[model samples]
Target: MNQQWRLDDGQQTLVLAARSGRLPECVYWGAPLPVTEDLVALHAAYALDVTGGMLDENPDLSLCPQSARSFPGQPGLVLRCTDEIRMLYGLCFVDAQQNGPDLRLSYRDAAAGIDLTFSFTTDPQTHVITCQTTLNTDRPVQVDWLAAPVLPAPQLSDEMIDVSGRWCGEFQLIRTPWSAGLRMREARTGRSGHEHFPGLIVPNRGTTNCQGEAYAFHYGWSGGHRMLAEELPDGRRQVQFGHATNTQAAGTQFQTAPLYITYSNTGLNGCAVAFQRHVRDRIVTDAHPVRPVHYNCWEAVYFDHKLPELQDIATRAAALGAERFVLDDGWFGLRDDDTSSLGDWTVDARKYPHGLTPLIDHIHSLGMSFGLWFEPEMVNESSALYRAHPDWVLGPMDQIRGRQQLVLNMASADVRDYLYDRIAAILSAYDIGYIKWDHNRLLPAPDAAQTHGTYALLDRLRADFPQVEIETCASGGGRIDFGILKHTQRVWLSDSNDALERLRIQHDAALFLPASVTGSHVGPRHCHTSGRTIDISMRAWVAAQRHMGFEMDPRELTDHEAKVLTDVTAWWKANRDWMMRADILRLDSADPAVIAEQQLAQCGSRFVVFAGKAATSAQIQPRPMRLTGLDPAATYCINVINRDHTPGLSRGNPALKSGPLTLSGAYLMHHGVTLPWHFPETMWVLEGTRK
Candidate 1:
């Protein structure tokens, strides 16, 4: 079961060769290698090889590669998987250099798929190995690239290792002070995937002889990677890998996870590698602990809401007990609408007057945190940035005939520096707490001149600000990919904020991301994207079960509306602890209206059930139920936070007062909780403690 892959850096282009003779290998030119059977020449088998570019003649070409040809070697690259986890593992390929470090092998675990690529460099004097696992997402993704301090000996774990399953792994070589890690992505297509590989190091983290960088994480629906760069104390620099994600599958219905390994260079001849905990089988929800429910002023202000108006919203938001207040768009430049304002990042003097300070101060005055919006990766033709840095924008430097209004080239060093400084300055100017950094566009058609430069630019920003949080948005959902999640704290589930749309969107979004990392907000119906009027109650019900929040103008809502919000948010705050710490048990949603529910177990003694009504019609009702999975003698209280136009209802009134609900398999099977025939949007938190 010795499976592996390799790469060869010759006089021509870099060549990547896979281990198996059966599986065809791919070679990436200026653009990605073609996976589909193509009508083109470079991507097809036995076509013209893209050689040259190695002497560093700009290294930019449509098809200038030496060529990475793969055929079975004398003894084929040995590959195997240690676990039957249906995970991808084993050696994928290796790249040999002329005189420098030669052997480069790639390994990946399905548990921690390839969110990052591994790089290893040697320390000159000691010959110690320094390894770093850098993310390849839209933002800076964090991954540790350190294994046990001792060298990897040729010993295998006694655990029954399986050769058929795929597993992901990372390694690195070190010289005297510098370290570089080798990351390998491998997977076996056979049926034996669950077996365990014991030779791998037991993952762990310890305070090392290294300084941590202050950087930010960014993510979206498309490509994502982590950047670990900093504008040093003295403004020098020390960059490492942030975090990265990858979608290993292809096509419309594909699959992926937040999987990657981290390596660190400890002293001695020792290095370390540990599996990161970013992968999951179901939707990741913010319903878990440590995440907060937030509110944003995008739909409310759209660019019309000035500082004072923003202050008004903030005042109410704080009163409503909102934890975070995000000032979306219009705050920057002369952005009157979505079309004209992008690319110009300066504050709109007409609206902001004394800059963003006043508004940020006002938000803090209300005892709430502040967030700002930035569409840094895009440029509008009307933007000052586009006019000033025309060469920095993507399109043919000769002619501005691209379909896009304009695109920022994040790959160039100057462009990357400009964005980093501009954003850092804005964030620093105000006591800004969060950023709704958006990319309203998708990855533009790659130009021979700027692909690597753009990628490098994004990587730099991510590594520069790891502590600040950013939300990834790509024209809503067009760019939502695992590659982007590695760097972002959370991603907007979709541009379509419709509750019904959100049900499926979030369901899909959660497939790889945790709920906390996915944003679900309640906004006005006739949603911004679809303009569909959905029940606000239904919206709340769906959004609350995840990392929940709202994005509408409170002014537009009636007093009843405000109260409904205040009530539901209160319910979230109350039972949030349960949602945070427990493994959610979702009821079968074969019926779309059944929506989603999660059972939160705080401890063996206490538990709570969070449920929502997703249907819009008043006549649709869920049947009554004798719930299962409960201690029969346990005392229970059901708290239903209803969102209909009910008169004079206050928080003190227990909507559905029931207690000590007994549980039996037959009773549970025969009865499901019944709701009002015409139930308004509502969420019920049923609480109990095991006796």
Candidate 2:
């Protein structure tokens, strides 16, 4: 029997080895190893030496660490029989198969009647390696934990960056230096909580946005998840990701969500590019190749959905170049506010006496496609559906509610069928092309079944209405992940339309998400969530940076604001073709006050830079912002596209502010761009065309 195997894409390689039929362990994972290298010798060298206070020999630390084997740190599996006999081990490898760039290995615990399988596949294009594990038993078992195949972290790393955020502020990066103990993060809010996003990045000691080495991992699960970054007392490190402990109920079989990992040779942006490409080009299917400009009326109308008012909003949104108008949250039942009539999916007669047809038709007549919002997985106790089937609510009968609503029992076949029927009926009756599928509240508890059932429903919907697009929004940005994104086309980045706050959130989120699926909107003049007003030009340009949209009431815009918005919308439309396909690269800024990014076209012919002055710089002069991912030998023409936004502060002329300058890409990337000084909350937009 073969004792060693390995899989390699062009950029990276993963080598696994096993002895005496024990479960295989990954001995090497990083930049590509030579094809002719000796796997056996490499595996031997990778083994750690047992020292004083440790066992006579080192434990394998196999893909599934075993408790019975006396492995230190967190064991990969936690199980029980009936109510006792918690320990189960002695698994033997039973099968192995290597095909192309994919590998599958199987193992079994005979006495326990348990079969475990680990699978891996590397995408040659995006260079992302996806891994998953499955556990099946002949009889019922209570499994508290089952991690995806564990991988070792580099010892040279000094710190780790994990994602953390809240309601209005999502995708904030927190960095913690490496230590000798374990670092654990668990999202137990049922939905992937706004507080803990399932991602981590470990950079080499001297890594930056454009240099050195980096490794990234994203647990692509929408339900609760737990991440373990542990450095054992022996100095060995490993990363484990799985559903939050005990999220699974007793079952005969269980499997984990796919764990996506990518190693970057060119610093953090390389990881960013890999994830961004894999998500947009590989995961999302049939996304209208040309992403339409969005106009959601949630902030504009809330629950006051009057026919004339909606018609007016639609006309205004269209005039400002919105191609898809999504009538948000208040068009159904008695949903006058967030609290009531959530489960009722019917069009409200009070708001639209003749039904949604009038408003939808008005939107369609204005040359924009119409979209409706639905919270299919939530129910108000005051709703007719909830009253009729109280048993359909998840958790205990006395469980607390969120946003005045209880979660629907998505695990129940009856619940899924009812939701599909209601949602499908609406699709058949209307010429709708999009659905803003909302999940405004967290579940009473974490249950993997709920996420699976939701996926099942989405799959059914996608098959039935292949052309209809769906946006997964959970209280703004709570449910954004690769798992949910597999079913939906777009993600509502955050509820806060405050440009200053958005500039930071969007910049950090660009580490994983691409510009095409991230929805950024221009909020009202007085930002509802943040309460700090931002300039119309600032709001418009920020929205234009991603999947452009407008969620504000167009009627409230002053003549100057309206013109500025219209011009920015036109600019977004002109660039959407290539911009949607661009790779968003976070630039290394010399000044911390300026948060910046460069969206480079896929063809490498052009790029645009958004340098947002988030706060007042302590230094009076702006610092040079270095760009990445450009050919050093190429020459390019650079122009400050938003030069008109320059506020007169008696500023001396900065070369970029005066006119376009033709410079070599090497000079642009190394010497960097110098923009005129700007007040806080302002942004400088630069366009570059390779000559």
Candidate 3:
């Protein structure tokens, strides 16, 4: 018997049906239907095969399981029986149940004593569908491969978009035409490394920022994961995402990570808005308080942890309108550099003769919160902690070290308890408001159990100390995913704070993550990674768009630069709500050297537009940049926020030295306004208030 089920979230509907005592298959996954209809009749009317036929008999057919059935690419599930291998495609359908917006379908192989269940959930507000699969067996079954949320792409999806980059330069967007063969992106570093993000976007031909159909998928796992986009022989497409499960013993039940999928007809921006809302409301339920303007001591002083020098820096930071002061690295056990003393979480008596009390009190007296950095998952061979517990490390006795450190065996209960107790002790002893939780090294020979251990540790910490905020940093953006975001408040996006490079990185990351959760800091003139010296205004402008912070020493700024910082910080503080809650829009531009973005207020009362020029052009005439996401009927007063405008530099469009310029929102968005084009590597910030 064929049983059909449908889940509707008003705006979208997902239809799935079981065929003749077998596993269920997806029928339709886009748009809304006014009435529930038979999926088989719909498929037949659309000239689609209900079973996708047999792979061998019809070479062009695309099967969902693609197991020993001879379909191309990877199989969805691989099961090792007593003497032979078996796949789930041939299993008999048992039953299905739907409760509210959740659905579960079960399949069973009586002879093999294997039971497989696929669970589906939908977010009513965002219209996002999340799916996961679980396998259970009476006998021992070694499961090799499995993927969740195996989605089918629409016929019109002809292009694919994803991101890839190296350390300090993450989230570089890449778009390519859909073709035959398998496109796979895997992260095996035991963390969501910077090389590839576990998100995929498929769009129709000629998709733009604001128009065309688009579909997006994001895996919520923080550990090793893989995303595959395969184009089958018959113009059919499949998108699969799941954790990298190497092998599992028999009698052990395996559950894959949840995969989220959303669709939009209004292009990538529409997909982004849906994802941002879903993440904020479902994944991260805690209210994200206004992100403070923080001052970090890493770029300023490196490993030099002198109390008096830090006190001086905190004073200057408070004077420059910093709300929090973070002391990064070198504050613990003989840790002058990264070479020694990582797991030893005790304060260095030589650096602070008394204790952290004096420094913490000083920062509090200055009306600023205090934050500390720690890498609890790593340890150095020379450290006292490692000498006492050598078996605590994950790898072999003679394992190769990275960053002069070895990975701690988080899978062990003893190791988890010790680290948790140490961190809990610090939280209990001091008035610490924040923790910069960092992971500097990758886990060697990672297992699924280790990831569960890490999650349990974080869950215990958050439950014990809910007041203290934790920022996840894995050598700059190596562990950015919805799984980690559920526990941490924010993430360190990258180590490179070069303003020009950060513009691209932040833009691409904002596609799936909100700006409030992305940590952007203004670094020194010479960036540590890129070594590019950008103007202070440009640096402050780029960082202000996200969770704003500063990583450089205030003592290094000139008088003019100090004023600029003060003004920028004040402006950001006043407008923090808009940056935190506004809908993001990436504006289209004809010039390659220009990058523009707009943040439209949810209330429809205000908006902010950022236009930056990377290099100067030889053309004297400036082009009028068209703005987006504004009410056409409303009138608005557009004012330049940054006061660093150069007048009379360009020949055609002269700078306006006047008060607020008034114009209708329709005119400003359609006809647009021209900006100064003479100076290279500069940015302009414009604020619009509906009048």
TM-scores for every candidate against the unseen true structure:
0.57, 0.98, 0.94
lDDT of 3 by residue, 614-676 (tens): 777556565777777678888888877764466565444344334568787788778886665
In angstroms, give how far residue 424 of model 1 lies from its true place.
Answer: 1.6
| Poorly placed runs, candidate 3 (over 4 Å) | 36-40, 46-70, 81-89, 245-251, 285-288, 617-620, 651-671
- Model 2, residue pairs in steric clash: none
TM-score of model 2 (CA atoms): 0.98
At residue 172, what lDDT does model 3 achieve? 86
Model 3 alpha-carbon miss at residue 102, Å: 2.0
TM-score-superior candidate, 1 or 2: 2
> Which of candidates 2 and 3 is the stronger one according to TM-score?
2
Q: Which pairs clash (backbone N, Cα, C closer than 3 Å) in model 3?
A: 141-250
Error of 3 at 687 (Å): 1.0
Task: Give the Å error, residue 488, model 3.
Answer: 0.7
Model 2: lDDT equals: 0.90
